[model samples]
Target: MYRLLAVDDDPAVCRALFDYFSSRGFFVATALSAGEALRLSQTPPPFDCAVVDVLLPDQSGLKLCQAIKETGAAVVFLSALGSEDDRVQGFLSGGDDYLCKPYSLAELEQRVLARIRARQGTRAQQVLRFGPVCIRLDRRQVEVEGRPLELTCSEFDILVFLAQHRDAPYTQDAIYRAIWNQPGLDGTHTVQVHVAQLRKKLAAALPEHSLIQTVWGKGYRFSPPPTA
Candidate 1:
């Protein structure tokens, strides 16, 4: 009996998700706006999963996904924009998965269920360090100069992946396949946005080090500093 949250401005989509996922044994709840969804999560038992639409009346679902990702709920982005960059933005925003609009209901259910199961997977023990930044995988905490930094789940995961494979260059497609665990990921730039977000946080945390660098046509690589 997993609790689910569905957010969309369209009444028809809202009803459809509610009715369909409910039949699938999810205790589904609905919200028409980002603010409404945030408010709903403020009070009670948090949702296990969220199905969010990118185009919403109040705010972009990307921002909403970042807001609630730390709650440990799986998020799947639903959007009409099907471009590579658009899908990348959805993934970069900390969503566990992305489904373009005009998608089949069956496919959506499969994605949503997969995301939920992925979130429920076991936690790994890993600690990565670069300068003053420290990432504790067991607790999923990121700290810089002994201070904590707020990062979305996707951002944290991307940084961990790069750090674990220091000096290794991975094309966007390769990184996307590894992180999303999907074969032959279609969206080209889907991995770039997440890397960019991680770099931004690293910049703020460790100004002296570039941390991740572009490899021209090769892709991106993690640059770790000399160990003391």
Candidate 2:
């Protein structure tokens, strides 16, 4: 099951999302404050994503997203303060998506599923197969020769982004802009760290082959499957 964290100061909103997502087969954890959300991040593995309200009891959702990013969790900001700046800040803080207030439950489910699918490193009906590794997007899991491979949040995101456009190269600037939302100079290292970490994990899990390849002076791309 995909586990999610729903952070909001309003008890009603928290309960509503919990009940809504639970019925749709998601295991939802509710936090009434940014402090509580921070506490939940310390929990062991299996936490897949988060939905945070911009206005919390003591802190902004953007701030909470920063904290969650350290734990490598995919985040979405659902806020009443639905301004362009608010959404941008959410992304800058490492949120995968931004949602405005009074959102439909259906839309929420779709976004949640998209995030989960992306994390599993799959998209649509086509299972991503690179070398000996396979990923099931709908199931949100990665497997190497039938065994599940553990991946951090960032690692999974990087892998999925690459897998989605196999054989297509993406520059460091483009990848950083897509994955890490921060701008200017300092953000450069963020993508590099994530890519390095992801590469190491993939190497450790499948050493015989490298799925993600460097493009000399360019950037990186997912190598296409070997021709039969």
Candidate 3:
């Protein structure tokens, strides 16, 4: 089932979304604020899409949309402000679609479904394969020899970043900043710890292969297997 997160401070709107999407066979999760929306996003089985209101009590939905995009979920903005500049700002914030307030729920549903379908359609091109290991970008899932591999959100993001770059090396600070979406905060130790844990897990899964390689004085690199 496609999972969705709806973030709107209006209780009526939240309830309507929950009810409408639920009836349409979607697993809907609603949050009344950006903080709540972020908290809900941390849960496993990440959301496939998020519907966010432009204005929120805690923070702007544009900021929240950027964070949601980090989870690899499509975002659609809902707003009462329908000006061209407002729509442009929404798209700049990584929103896939925008709907003006007083909108039809049916049309909203179609827009959301269309974005989900588009993401799924691109899944084939987004997948990463290295021998028995496979990474599905659309679903944010990793498998080894057809067995599902459980990983934390950070670990998965780190792996995806490195795997996409293939043989290119990345410093620990670079990886940390990229994955955490933060700048200048000393993440070397934290990155090392996560990379260590990730390496241990990968090693345990594939004893004969080393996918994440330590680049001596540099940092780390994803070295695909020779047969890959």
**Top candidate when judged by lDDT against the true structure:** 3
Model 3 steric clash pairs: none
After superposition on all C-alphas, the RMSD of every candidate to the true structure, in Å, is 16.5, 12.1, 9.1
**Residue-wise C-alpha lDDT for candidate 2, range 101-208, written one tens digit per residue:** 889989988997787668655444457776578877656678887789887766776777677656567777756544543324455577788888888887887787
| TM-score of every model versus the real structure | 0.53, 0.55, 0.55
Instruction: After superposing candidate 1 on the true structure, give the runs of residues whose Cα lies further than 4 Å from its correct spot.
Output: 122-228
The C-alpha lDDT values of all candidates are 0.78, 0.77, 0.86
Q: Which segments of candidate 2 are over 4 A away from where they belong?
A: 123-228
The TM-score obtained by model 1 is: 0.53
TM-score of 2: 0.55
lDDT of 1 by residue, 164-204 (tens): 66656777775664455354557467677777888888898
Model 3, residue 21: distance off in Å is: 0.5
Error of 3 at 12 (Å): 0.5
